[model samples]
Target chain A: MGGSLLEQLPLFLSYSNVSFLAQAFGVTVALSIVGCVVGYTVGALLAFIRNRHVVDVLPARFLSVGFSETFRRVPFLVKLMVVFFAFEVVGMRVSMFTVTATTVALAAAAFSAEIMRAGLEALPESQWDAAESMNMGGVMSLRLWALPQSWKVILSPALSFTVGLIKSTSIASQISVFELTYAAKVLNERGFSPVLSFGSLLVLYFLICYPLNLYARRLERQLERPRGWKSGAPLLAESEAA
Target chain B: MHYLEIDRFTASYDGKEQVLVDVSIQIAKGEIISLIGPSGSGKSSLLRGLMGLLVPQSGEVMLDGEKVDYTNRKSVKALRERLAIVFQQYNLFQNMDALRNVTVAPVKIRKRNAREVEEEATALLRKVGLGDKLHAYPDELSGGQQQRVAIARALALKPDILLLDEVTSALDPELVSEVLDAIRILAAEGMTMLMVSHEMALVREISTRVVMMDRGRVIEEGSADRIFDNPRTRRCQAFVGKILSH
Candidate 1:
């Protein structure tokens, strides 16, 4: 049997172990945040394609609906394998990290598209009518009037979804990506007790995610303030110069 | 060419259900033409169709001798730039204050100087009696005040023609006259206007011409005296009798 946790703690906290875990921790953070940014951009574009007032092309609408509907229904792990083998079958060698990150982005894009669609729908139909009648383009209406009004409806859910994606990045371990969960498993297999190995992971993940949870809650509170509490129509000025 | 012309126009919300069936009317510049009829008579649909809000299935809407092709973006944009409509719901941008709602299109879409637009918007708001409520959000204002903001917003565009789709219909009875007073100011100034209104008194007092519609077609139209006192069609007379009796 291994020595008591107190005695084993020093070896576990060695410089090499610490560095390896640090690298793994960095990977987890990068995967989630980068995935979210890429996911959101593509997702918003997908939403625009799906919007009748914006795209108005049936074929483009079909493609957008198909992408969101298909990706949203697939299990994340299955998506990871599909992506992994997709690269392999294409004869393109890619890193396991690339494979995992791509899967997270795929899942995030689908969910983010749906979330954004809901946000856009939250406004009254007349909002679009007013903008369209004013000769404001569909994209312009979204940026100036529609998106700003929908931020409160979108923010809480979007942040929460990002947090869920962060936790879900644990599944990246299945592909042998060097993220937190994989690091814990390696440490445990190397004779550290499961409690010490997994427990430390528990703390580290909490360290990374709790502040974000707090931040999401804070943002939700800020946005939950009554409508018209905003002092200005700032969105009107944002992209007009472009 | 007439300042605005809708000739044998047929339109639908969905392709199958014709809401504006063979609807045709014309407005000369500076004329206050009121559309009056029972609910679902498609009076409002004519204005919406002319804006390209409805699918124009047949006929034509010509402005200043240019035919409006609703399927063409530039044509629709040009049509909208020349004509602006205020809804009965007062579809002011809920995210904006009265002043911003009034100024957004002129400054952003029209690309006018922001300062000049604001100055004009402020004056327009004052004209509609919304000067005191310029900073107020739509949710913060009463129905009459909000509709006034919508009117000011529409006027800020400096359209060749202003369309009011039942502006007073959504108001509380006490709130109705404030909106009417604002429209009366426009009437006095000889602004080109097309309005769908149930306030027969306002329509009678301000409209040079009145068009009565029923089941997606214009049943009769003439000077207010002709339409109100002596409607030529049974549909028009029945509609006027039912509306006025209330």
Candidate 2:
């Protein structure tokens, strides 16, 4: 009297089942947003410190570069495991969710710092001269002039990294965090209907990630648009009446 | 008192090859001193040193009898407040429109009233013949317009001396005159200027003093008429002869 797989599809895709998945999806989205915000702020500060050569002492330079380089070279999953286990060994007693989010945030911060460093380097040396000639202080010059231009170089990669970070959060299931993937794993084990179960999981991730991918593409197009073309200034704008 | 005096200033990039060697010059108020030299002859580097863009290997810069201490933040800040530079590259902030480029430093760094700064920026833009392109970004404006905006940006600071480091060199031949026109107007207004230029004709016309440099030293320097027409050194004569022949 076993029902067909088709019959099981409705059971898995039902309102009650969908609601459960939605709740877990909500957690994933919330964690990603918070991680990204915290990560980006930390990353920007790190970039500023490094870019300004804030501390010229050899030890300070070595430590800053070493810290960032280590995080960048290490695999995210390995770093996550190490951080989680290290906290346990140290008897921190923090919640698994907190540890996982912090690890992701740290990882994201390191990457964004690297991205910002490259963006800053791409700017011309004359830019600093221009800023200095105006009697602008270092921080003020960086905020008003340097960051705005560097952000143009940073935006696309950063958004794309965010999408990847969202996907990577699925790994949180291993840490026993109640995200969408955890819910999916639980349902798949109970039903043993891998097709319907994993298929539904796929749909949920697609729902979240597809939009980001599309937006990233749109942003690329918008950014690549010729400099003055952003406001859709007409052909005659260049030759406008004096 | 000299408005600006560069005494025995020597500058180098890597401490290996000197860019400016014992270069000394004095500029009076309202004087347009044009630095003329062949490529790699340290014309721009001299201007940069005056702007505090380079550290002198030895020697000092004095503005109005006060020593400019490039190593001290406060002194350099004060030095910059009175001395602004317009680079050949324009170096306009690409993120902002022309008006913001002119207003940002004044309002943000100088802590001037924003509204007043904006008003002055608007007027400066107009004076540069960029009144119509006030909102244009650096990349949107033509090279001529961008350079003019850069000049306007420098003017926003109300500097006592304006350093023009080959400001028109990067412009196309047709676009060069627009930027030069802006500088000419500034000159007419009696703005104190130290310019490094290759436009021999324009330099001859506008300069109060002409300095000729070769191999990182000032070989000949005098009144524009004397340096161009009645040069003293063989180096200056040959330099003028080649330029005049062309």
Candidate 3:
């Protein structure tokens, strides 16, 4: 346990499947981007539906609640299995990439809806009144004013969700998606040490997610500060003096 | 018939317990009326009802001798477009600068040309004494400045009437005068206004007529001098006494 893991890392590098690593990295990055885009669109639609008062009426209410609960409560692996198997059974014949992207997006959409709803809820009621008094009608006010403000509050959570999404793509390897985890698994099975292969995979995830986390935190701090308090000395000195 | 009439109006958050009970009021063209009341006396609700933000359970709201139809979407839009509201909270759009907050609705909803809207917004902001703060966001402005921007936003549409719901309540005591001063300018220009305020001095100075509300009912109303100097009802007298002493 005390020995340097980097020393043992050469054994894995010696087997040197550079092309496989490159393919895995490309697939992982592609999957994350596609998944986040699809997730954000679906999440925004779901949030709109859930937040709408018209949905309180009958089947829509029940369906929305059921959709939210089912997607949120079910494990992503089970969702992956259902999606892959169902598509196969229906003679749809999708690639493993399609299945993984769809599953990750569906899972992320459920979580993102809650994040967006929280952002919308955090806005003051007075904003709506102001918009109305400006002669801004229903959807126009929401599109122009409310959503822009909501985006600021939702930014940090949305970034965190994207990081989770990058990690969750590993589970796609179980469905033979050829992402980073699959490459690691193949290397481990081909006589490379399990510790080295898995360790490298962990490092790759950290490299992807750590900077994102830092940026999100930085944004959160920037937004939390009162406006006009950012000039170098006098503002800081005034705040401190107060 | 009055230009605006709210007859036998009653409203409640929950339908059962009416917050504004059988309230009736009338405003003639180019008139500025101030609604003065204690907290929870339903001044805001009455204003909201007239704006069609709240539907009175049983009442007739007439605009220019025609019944104002609250249920019809187009009519509601027309009515709302003709009238504007300024809130106690200075509900200026936080993400936008003062100019944009004033110009957005004109450009988007009213479909006015962007250049013309900007010019109009700038002029209105200047009128409210916020010409220098035109590019500043609401969060970047002081409370008084934000309220003035709110006033500019309301004025941009050039609505037939402006409803002010305790517009000065959220201001610091020292800041209240700045907002009241802007409002006084609007009144002096003969902008028809229905102001719900707790500022007795400002109300006395600016309002042509004052209506005092108590327990959701219009307890007293007359020329500003009559109501301010010699109250007729015990409720009005008590209300005025409490406010004056404070």
Highest DockQ scorer: 1
Q: What is the interface RMSD of each candidate, in Å?
A: 3.7, 8.1, 10.5
lDDT of each: 0.87, 0.82, 0.80
Q: Write the per-residue lDDT of candidate 2 for residues A1-242, one digit (tens) a residue.
A: 13678878777778988898889889888878888889888887777667653233566556656767888888777877988988989989887777778877877888888888788777887787787767665677676667666666888888888888888888888888899889888888876377766777788888888898898788777766224322223312422321
Error of 3 at A8 (Å): 7.7
lDDT of 3 by residue, A96-189 (tens): 9999988888887888877877887777876876776555654675676667777668889889988987898899988788999999999878
Candidate 1 Cα deviation (angstroms), residue B1: 5.1
DockQ ranking from best candidate downward: 1, 2, 3
- TM, chain A, every candidate: 0.91, 0.84, 0.81
lDDT of 1 by residue, A1-242 (tens): 39999988999999998998899999999998778888888888888888887778999989888999999999888888999999999999999988888888888888888888888888889878888899988888987778878888888888888888888899889989999999999999999988888998999899888888898888778766335423234533543444
TM-score of chain B of each: 0.98, 0.97, 0.97
RMSD of 2: 4.9
Alpha carbon lDDT at B151, candidate 3:
87
DockQ of candidate 3 is: 0.28
Give the alpha carbon lDDT tens digit for every residue of B82-117 in model 1: 899999899877777888888888878988876678
lDDT of 1 at B132: 82
Candidate 3 differs from the real structure by a C-alpha RMSD in angstroms, to one decimal, of 6.6
Q: Among all windows of ten consecutive residues in candidate 2 chain B, which has the lowest summed lDDT?
A: B107-116
Tens-digit lDDT string for candidate 2 (B1-246): 888999889988766678899999999999999999788899988877777777678888898899988778788888888988999999988877888788777766776766677788889999989989988888788999999999999999999999999988899999999988898899999999999998887898889999999998999988888998899989889888998898
Q: If chain B of candidate 2 is superposed on the true chain B, what is its TM-score? A: 0.97
Give the higher-lDDT candidate: 1 or 2. Answer: 1
Arranged by lDDT with the best first, the candidates are: 1, 2, 3
